[model samples]
Target: MLQRKTTKLINKHLLMSLVVVAFASTSLELAYAQKNQTATKKKSSDISLTSDDKIFLELREASKNNEASKAKDLGQKLSNYDIADYVAYFQIKPRLFDKGGAPRAETMADDAVDQFLKKYDGTALADRLRNDWLLVLGKRKDWPTFDREYAQFVLDDDTQVKCYALQSRLTKGESVNVLAAEVKNILLDSRYFGDACPDLVNSIYKANGFSKHEVATFSRMAVENNFETLANRFDVPDPMADIVRSARKSPEVAFRDFDKKAWRTSKENTAAAWGSVGQYLAKKLDPNGLKAFKMQHELGHHHLLTPETQEWKVRAALREGDWRIVKETIDHMTPSVRKRDPAWTYWHARAQKELGDESLAKESLQALSDQYHFYGQLAREDLGMKIHVPKRVAADESLVKQASSNKAFARAVRFYDMGLRFEGNREWNWELRNLSDKQLIAVAEHAKRIGLYDRAVNTADRTKLEHDFSLRYPTPFKESLAPIAGSIGLDTNWAYGLIRQESRFIMNARSHVGASGLMQVMPATAKYVAKKIGMNSFKPSQLDDMKVNLTLGSNYLNMVLQDLDGSWALASAAYNAGPGRPKMWREKLPRVVEGAIFAETIPFNETRGYVKNVLANASYYTAMSSNKTPSLKQNLGTVSPKASVLSELP
Candidate 1:
């Protein structure tokens, strides 16, 4: 956006440079933490920040660490900045955050919050601050004030806040039964057991809104999420609580106890406790869990299994090659849950075929073949058809100019330049809420033109009726990356596919777990790759270099691919979840399993999604890179139990 004769591109980085540096400096974890666009007249992605920009970043850091004194000092220094509200909000937020990291409403002692709310009214920052205040009020049971302000809370998207809203309703004498139903639906997220949610659940149980079975099932779910404290507080009555205790101590012991007469007193409660054990063991890829689940079915207790329990049973069945159980589990799922994943349909068909219902199996797969995704690709291959990419579709060029004039797009570009990805993404998404398919294409095209490679792909991907594969699977640094990939005897397009998924083509992207650069390579992995490739001058800092990241990433990827016998599904899983897991997961396979089945059953939720997406992206990249149609089944190939090779790799 700076005045210049030449235009430039603006792409967003994963995290701020300070966070990336801090993460890279201490990259020691073995597990992966699971978990942009373009524009303009235009702006450089690496645009230099003024002194005010430096102050903004420092204020953000101070806010994060709750350094109120430092943030206040810095906030005062940026009074004249165009977005001084940003600095002031940072100054005020630190005071609100408690030592446990939750904000308390009691911290708002003066008119600081009131003045800021009035000045920045209608802005996203104001809405965000209001949300924070609501959390604090809800925690304190300030229902009158909480109810009044909650109505004005713009993005009522926080689960805890929503739970608090329900709690407020109960305090205001709302019907406990209705509030309980809402609580059950909204409080499923177990990432954290924050204050309001536990209170709400306890109040619901105290009011007898939940039946005995519901209490046992809900308590079982709490234990599954490793919230033993909450489970105990639920006081799941005698025998079942004893079963839960046994199951939590050790899944192996729980499997043995399933045969005990006492554990079988109530079919529903026993199924709940037993299902909890099966779910936990399934995550660990233990086949014995499926054995315990089969006992549930024999005792006619399977009907009591919760949705989460039933879902994990499917994963356990596939790993153990129990085709009958796979078919039975899917058959028991509600129509809504069964249809939620195409994998269920695909596997249900496969299981039916194995169980002597070939015609019905073929009919089911034929239904799944037309869609475009990992399972759809496998279904097509099964039906004797090659997976074909849709013909490229484009929007008109004039829309680019229209997009360039849009205020949200301009600020998004600026925000990306300053490495404020959170703000940039918010601005970009706000404008995309109602864009038509072709308009989305237009925005994507403009984003691609200005070097917003990440946003171009993401925006183009949103279109249901039109698409530009070149924009969606762009090779931003292909000139350097392609040769590195090829030199290592790896597929360049697959590298592009992986990079596209890893960082959305950001050059200096760094994940929270210290996976850095274009490919999001972890520092330890980068160091190991460096040693393997004999790159004597390598330092972890060099991972941010375009060439270095691609080199190490491709090399590491090649090693996994080679060891896994070129199974893209396995390699992709290895890349995301470390080599040891897929190797162990693969070794547990009873026989040669379909690639789609292998991916669908990956125990780690993030790794499962990661493998499916990377292979799907590669399939499209293959079509774009060469005129020939691509086959994802070929990439996912067959996942078989193989012998040693990469067993020694980290």
Candidate 2:
């Protein structure tokens, strides 16, 4: 099973059956929209609709077509059209902006939106409207209004709004130095920058919020990360811009031409350039990545690189088995970058230990060992301790009752019923933001009761003081899966671990790449495995079948495991990154390295994380299932060349 990000929803008829809670008689408008959902569904032609249903459906179409007059006329025909807020929203949206994103002077959207916000304050749609209105205000440079609304922007998740928030600060005559650090963090990822973000960066640079060298590094970092729009808007020299372009289009050529063209600019900053090219090369798996990084190391500018490039340098050095370089590169990283993820903290400690700094290593490992994740378990092993589960905290009946009646949880269920998972998860997480450990466990229990296993596992996982491994690592299809795994000489715990990560036991889950079911197997991979197991008349569509999907998924996993000399870490990586990739990585190994080190140096971020999580998840499952000490170090074993490569495993 590879990556599957898309959620597969069942029939919409199921949605019609879901009981949406009515907002306590306070929302007479939305109540009308939901109250009739309990009625039996009939064919459109066979149905004799009520006057309200007819008016509401027409209002919906009118609003969709932006027939403002027709929608208003329809709205006037009914006092209770359930979801009246939506009708109001549709009417105001067209008025706020016509076909383009401009409000005509004749439109009265401003007053209408104010009324909607007042009526629906604290609701999800109200927050959404505020977000939309803030964008319009941002475009109009209405700083006072933007500032007021931005304060109530519950999510504040939009990059453009974030950019506008900064711009509003500047408009209020805030000191550039005061906002410089925030600006830098915002501009870190240019791809999320959107239209307003580039201008924000430009404004900061032009206002001297950032120095020339700092601007250069940020701009080049953006370009190297496949975002050229920021660099184009940046006021850099033509030569520097050209260098970013070359590096983007062709890293090898740019790396070669960089030295010759260094004097073209002020020659004050080559760190961004070298770092940019090296990152591009490193991503391509080219040997010149190390060569270019060595140049940055020689110039003493490694620390001047972007955080991503700094991480790549560390990964590149680790892959090369150069402990000194790994230590040095990690040392050059900023403190924030070094401490952001436990993986880095763990790797830094390992690097130091490799260089005979046990005192430094022990401190980092000791801090990291308290966690129970992949890196945490590895850290525990490094400190010579076995993996152990934290004591379980039992949920109470009172907490369960509170969770069952939770208004936010009810709304989340409604959204999930409508297959709007983004909105549902946002609502679910918002409620979780302030909940106590006890409340979280109760919420998870309630979620599990309603067949929301993904939410159940995720919520249970957030508990810090008390642990519940059964809730965290739920076994949805254990009855069917255990024997299937055993028949193929597979550890049922490993299957559960991989399945937990893949689809969270959602029977109908589908990924962005078309992988499906609990196994998250690709359609093509499903067919290949089907044929290998002599499955006649197997269609890709049948991947949704529980029994068939498990059979194929387990077989594929065992195939990779055998090919990888039974190394769980290697097989897990192969499963995620393809069996051939792990082989290639192993073949490049100067000598056999520790499994954890090999995993740490994995080039693909997603696959690297996948391997760690899958194996760690497997270890946890083992600890819960058997009377055994689940050791991540033992699970990982030693990473080495495959005993016998399966060229056709893919």
Give the clashing pairs for model 1.
9-450, 36-455
Q: Estimate TM-scores for all models.
A: 0.82, 0.83
Which sections of candidate 1 miss by over 4 Å? 1-49, 66-70, 103-122, 140-154, 168-180, 232-249, 257-265, 299-308, 331-372, 379-386, 523-541, 646-650
lDDT by residue (tens digit), candidate 1, 350-454: 899889998998899889886666677777877888776767777677877899789889988888888777667667865776898778889988898888876
Worst 10 residues of 1 by lDDT: 21-30
Return the top candidate by TM-score.
2
Task: Write model 2 residue lDDT over 1-650, tens digit each, in one string.
Answer: 12322222223332111100111110011111231212111235434566776676677667656667877787777756655676677667655555544334442578888889999898777887888788778877788888889999897867788988999898778999878777655554556666677667678878988776776676676666656665666665223556667876888999889977665545346656677677777766566777778877777755458778888887777766777878888887766677666778888888899899999999999998888788888888888988887777877879989888998889777655544455466577768867888888888888888898877888888888876777888888788888889988998988888887666666766544566677768776777778988897899878878999999899888987887788898888766666666776777665677888788777776667667778888888888888988878878888765443445555
How many angstroms is residue 270 displaced in model 1 relative to the true structure, after the best TM-score fit?
A: 2.0
lDDT of each: 0.72, 0.71
Q: How many backbone clashes does candidate 1 have?
A: 2
Q: Relative to the unseen true structure, what is the Cα RMSD of model 2?
A: 8.7
